[model samples]
Target: MTTPLPIGSTIGILGGGQLGRMLSVAASRLGFRTVIFEPGADCPASHVAQAHIQASYEDAAALRRFAERVDVITYEFENIPTSALDILEALRPIHPNREALRISQDRLTEKTFLSNLGLTTAPFADIPDAAALDGALQTIGTPSILKTRRFGYDGKGQARLSSPREAAQAFSDMNGAPAILEGFVDFSLEVSIIAARSQDGQVSAYDPGENVHEGGILRTTTVPAKIPARLQTDAVLLAAKILNALEYVGVMGVELFVTPTALIVNEIAPRVHNSGHWTQNGCTVDQFEQHIRAVAGWPLGNGERHSDVTMANLIGDDMDRVPALAQDGACALHLYGKAEVKPGRKMGHVNRVTD
Candidate 1:
């Protein structure tokens, strides 16, 4: 196993979203310096990182410089360009590795990988063309969803179909890109497991948190998910299986659908997840800290929960509630430093911890 990067070492981060912002905060707590590489100025992560690389992901010269300056690298999100990774990997080590990124970037590849590991997922098929869509619809059935093969997140690039006529419009919405048609799952509730794996392959997972979404965007997460204990255990086991399957060496979030008879894999985020934000106040070690430990080769910390917590996302205009939420007892408010409150945008979140 590779030795952990010691305290005071610089860690490179690939995205500048809220996830990167939280990772920077956690890394600082462990005495590590962080450098953020992103194209946009005034990104949320740029506010907390030690330094910022204000350049595009495809800027090879800048990427090389970033790789030279950092001891190790990790990303906050999965949508990073593959070519950018090639340049960074040549100069520095990237945790979770490129294979994990490639598999998770495409919906069909992720579903196939999970199925190969003996995990249950929604019935799905590749949609290569309009003709293929007809066959896929016949097999996967209607009242399903058609998702683009790549770059889809936060309910984007997905279309719902209640009938055959809707399939063509859905395909057109995706601009005939590589896509997958997935049957809708009849689930009782949705939950997610936040898990970490060390470089030596040691793995640990946190309790699944129940999730509720608004307009397809996550709105709230509550710990001690109301579900059978066996299903909860299954969630953790499924997350471990995914981490092990990818030989992943960082924090990963696995979203699952708990049904009457079984558990079905929904989607996997190969990094710290928004749903796991409750961990910041609820657990002994938050997902962000665990991610830092795994990528830095440090010993993973205890993930025990000390409190019952509920996390509410401050999306768009919800940021206006910060003043009132901050006044509440036991609530920790986190603002992402985003300038705009555009519809559907995530501005921040608040966690209420109850002992």
Candidate 2:
């Protein structure tokens, strides 16, 4: 299918993180130009893009100029302000559409959407205020999680309540924002499926990646998850259903909880995802390229896996381990050109492919 915007046309991208960086690199390979709109002066994505509009998300004039220059737009992150999207969409097309963005931005809305679709998820309830928190606790129980409805990522803006005493403190710590209390599930492992939906509504999903997290941050993701083949097929079908429901057009990441009873939808990321980094070395068509194809209205590429892979995130001081990691013959080390290595920061990743 030919895109509304053709190859060699410029694409505007929101956010300048590592995901945007990879998207820009992929766009360049496909003969498309990328104009990155980011407020920061030296973001990782700006290094690769043809143009960088250095302005805040709320800057309407800058946004208008960016929209005028690019043919179509897409974002790397879901936390983009709604007002900013309003401004950009008035000028150019934004893929995955506003409903996808709206559903993905809030945990409560996301859970409700999944439930409405008959998808299993952790039991959850809304916490409107301090008074509501007690009721939520009673309903969802202790050993549960309390997360803000919006703008939480990388384990930030969330608290676990194992005891009644921790509940009020968790509420107070969040500055009394709207929140959700979710009952914890006993899962064998966490997994995620990354899939792409093209302009013609065709969907293709990569093999699910089994993930392990530490201190609220992703630690590693291994493909061809050591799970039953039928379960993996179920995961892919669920993800495709989600994308098709959203009428989504671009790459999306669906995190899942592989429980004893069923696979539950954990969360949805409406763009290229961290757990999918292994596809860089393991798939015939990587998630980044697939996103570029979908948003540009090009044909989706093959999403076949070539070899089993383990993708390890480089967090904070983990950068120091690069030399040793690079020495391994099977490891492909990818570093984000960020100068400082702060705790919990995702600097890069290493994909180790094995037979």
Candidate 3:
């Protein structure tokens, strides 16, 4: 077993988005300091972290300095530059590890990994060129979605085709990037399990949460997913299986599709996830805290839910409703300190808890 980080040790976090902000907050609560290495100035996490290194990921000097300052490393996002990671890994240990990042960074790789594990996922094929797209369209059929293999999230880099006639326009949307064609699944609802694994291979999973997405952006996630007990158990077990396969030492979000018969794997996020936000008010150990604990080599915390929670995201202009949302005594709001809120951008989230 790896030694747990001392209380006052500093943790280096990559990316300075809202996830990093929340992770920093959780680390502080655990008596650890945090430093953020993100290029963007005045990023959300920079506001709360002990220090912020505003430099490009290509700056090996900056990455080395950042790594030297912290005892361990973790990241908020999966699309981190390989060069940046190479430098940091040589200096300090990175949790959730490079293998997890390598798999999650590419859609094709992630799906292949899941399928190889005896997991059910959307029927998919690699699309490296127009010919490959045609080949995939022939086998996968229509009513499918074309997604870039890497760097896609929140519905970006995705194009839908109702028929092969629309293939040209859909493939054009990829802009020459390597893509994957995923046949749409007929499912009842989407649910996600937020699971964590410690350094010693111990695994724990919070109850799955039902999710709703609009315009490809997550809108709300409700705890205690409205699924059968057997399915719920299956979701948790599948999540644990994924974490253990990767020897993942951090939190992971596994999204699944519930069909009439079985659950299909949707995708997995290597870092803390938006759908797991309900854990803030619903569980003793929220996902962010659990992530920090795992990366710090501390024992995984009890994540049993205590309250039923429905978490709603405040997207872009939705920030206008903050006044009304704040009036609700039962709602707990977590706002990201983003100065400019563009359309579809996440500004904050509200967890409405019920006893």
Candidate 4:
């Protein structure tokens, strides 16, 4: 087992979004301070972190200074530039490892990796150009999605093609970026497993959560997913296999498509996930703190769910309902201190304990 960092140590967090904001709060609860490195000024995490470094990710000098202050580094998002990682990683350890980030950063690479691990993923083909789109379509077929290879999230950088004629438009939507064409799956429901692995290779996973998405953005996640007992066991084991394969430390979100015969892997997020937010109310140790604990080299926490919980994201106009949500005693509100309220922006989330 890796030696746990002593109390009062500082953890460096990259990306000052809501996930980083909640991570900072969780670190504080464990007697650890957090220093946030974000390019944007007054980011959501800056409000609660011990210190915030406002500089671009590629700024070498700023990264050096930030690394010098913290004992370990972790990121809330996966799209961090390799140049920035080269600098910070040379100075301090970054948990979940760069390999995990590298694989998850690209759709093609991620699918290949999962398949190599004896896992099932949607039929995928590389689309390097418009010409490749036609050839890819011949194999993967229509009613598929064309997604950029890198830096896509929350339904962005993707176009759906219903037929072969739409292939040209789908490739055009990519704006000449490298892309992947994925065949559609006949899924009964969507579910995700939130798993954590300690430095010593100990792994634990929370119960799978059934998810609902609207306009390509996650809307709600409910624990005690309506899956059969056998499938639930398969979900947990498959998640553990991923953690082991990556030799990963810290938490990972594994999204899956539940089919009649098998569970198909959709994608994997290398950090705390929106789908796992139900853990906040259902489990004694939520995904955020579990991530902090694992990266800090602490023993993994008990992630067993004790109650049924449904978590709903507050997007755009959803903020207006906060008043009514606050009055409900069973609801736990977690609002990100983001200043602007734009359409489709994730402002906050509420977890309602059902049991």
Candidate 5:
């Protein structure tokens, strides 16, 4: 896994979502091929990847066929099943490592890892049962969020608690799943640092991007975040610290709460992030390409921004504005080519660049 993947070697991607699609395109730019192994049919990545294996993760024979074709493996998402990963890991090297995925797959585990790293995080406690929920409510208190331990995203599988009385309904919403209670972070804004670590242990980070979310989904990411210079440096340093601690190879998105005091870790995504899409129009080596390079064991590329930019996600109905957006000279559109769009689904993104 130390040697760089030569030109035309195929990379196996574990998901066929938009992130995988974009990663496939990036790998092509570096003369490498990509194969997407996804359970769903007609996935976004399949449209661009050099090859596609449409089979369930539990299908050992299919997973073996996929592992045989690729030089290495990487994933677009963290919720990949452990059984599937165990099968793939024995065949090909998976970048960013299984430890990073293990920590990120659960809210309680991720929060604990960050706290153990000497990083600031919101007060959190594990909730394994209804009794645990009551205890966590007493310990973590009201005005907090109760989130499922795994498989939660875009504000789903979680609930906000204004008072302890709401704990019953919140715990019920989990349907007996493991959960975590997190004390609310009183922050001024949310920012994310998109970072990468090369196979050789070198690290690189992009400027922090201030994020705005609606309905628990990212709406826009504006770079040159409205944070003091010192906090921005702190954000990058903390992201690098996490990367180095994991011996991670590939890109990661570190979301943080910008408080009046120290920056608080909100969450970490061990892959190319929605916020970093601004790099598409603002930097020479965007996050996608940077990720492809790292996982391929090549030298990481420059991530310094050349222009201030704003990246806005095109949710379900947002696709209607494509015609008008396409005519706009300052913005560049990157559509996912999804066959159907449901409410809250990320259909595409547009990056508006400015000097």
Candidate 6:
């Protein structure tokens, strides 16, 4: 087992976004400090982190200095450049490991990994080129989505093909990138399990949260998702199986498509997820704190929910509603402290809690 770092130790975080910002707060609550490494200036995370390293991921010198200062390293996102990992891994321990990052970085690799573990996923075929796209379409059929294998999130890097006629446009949308065609799933609802595993291999999962999306971005997450009792049990068990398979330490978000017949794995995020934001109001130890505890080599929390919560994201224009939302006594407002509010950008979120 890895020895736990002392309370005063510094934790290095890659990627400075809202997730990193929240993580910094959690670490501070536990008496640990955090330093953020991000390329962008005035990043949301930089507002709260003890220190911010403003450098590109490939900046070897910056990465070296970052690694030297922190006792342990973790990331808020999975799109970290491999070159950067080479520099950081040699200096400090990275939680959830490089193998987990590799698998989750690409959609094709993630699906293949899940299938090999006997887990169910949406039927998919890799599209290396135009020819492969045709072949995959012939097999997977129409009404499928062609998505870039890497660096996709919040509805980006994807094109929908309703039929064969739209194939050309969809493939052209890829912009010469490797892609994957996923067969459409007639799911009833989307739910995700926020699970965490400790260094010694103990795993715990929060109650699955039902998700609602708008234009590919997560809009809201309702805890105690409207799933059957047996399905909820299945969700937690499948999530545990995934953590055990990866031998992962730290938190993971496993998205699942709840069909009438079975649960299909949609994708897995190797860090705390947007869908888990509800945990902040509903659980004693929220996802952020759970992640900090796990990465710090501390024991996992119980993850028990004490109330129902509905977390809604304040997207671009949604910020206009913040004035009214802030006035509601039952709501808890958490803003990212971002200066600009572009369309589709997440500004903040509010959690409505009830017993």
* Model 5 clash tally, residue pairs: 0
lDDT of each residue in 244-279, candidate 4, tens digit only = 999999999999999999999999999999998888
lDDT of 5 at 269: 97
Q: What is the alpha-carbon lDDT of model 5 when measured against the actual structure?
A: 0.94
Q: Number of clashing pairs, model 4?
A: 0
Candidate 2 per-residue lDDT over residues 1-355, each given as its tens digit: 4544566999899988899999998898889999999999899999999999999988999999999999999999998898999999998999979999999999999999999998999999988898888988887888998899998776688899998789889998788789988899999999999999999998999999999999878999998898899999999899998999999999999999998779989999999999999999998789998999999998899999999999999999999999999899999998989878998899999999986
lDDT of 6 at 218: 92
Which residue pairs clash within candidate 3? Answer: none
Candidate 6 lDDT over 1-355, as tens digits, reads: 7688799999999989999999999999999999999999999999998999999987899999999889999999999999999999999999989989999999999999999988899989999999888899999998999999999777888999999888888999989899999999999999999999999898999999999998898999998899999999999999999899999999999999999988999999999999999998998999999999999999998799999999999999999999999899889999999999999999999999966
RMSD (CA, Å), candidate 6 to true, equals: 0.9
How accurate locally, in lDDT, is each candidate? 0.91, 0.92, 0.95, 0.95, 0.94, 0.94
Off by over 4 Å in 5: none
Model 3 C-alpha RMSD vs. true structure (Å) is 0.8
Task: Report the poorest 10 consecutive residues by lDDT, candidate 6.
Answer: 1-10
- The pairs that clash in candidate 1 are none
96 in model 3: Cα distance from truth in Å? 1.0
Question: lDDT (0-100) at residue 113 of candidate 5?
Answer: 96
Better of 2 and 6 by lDDT: 6
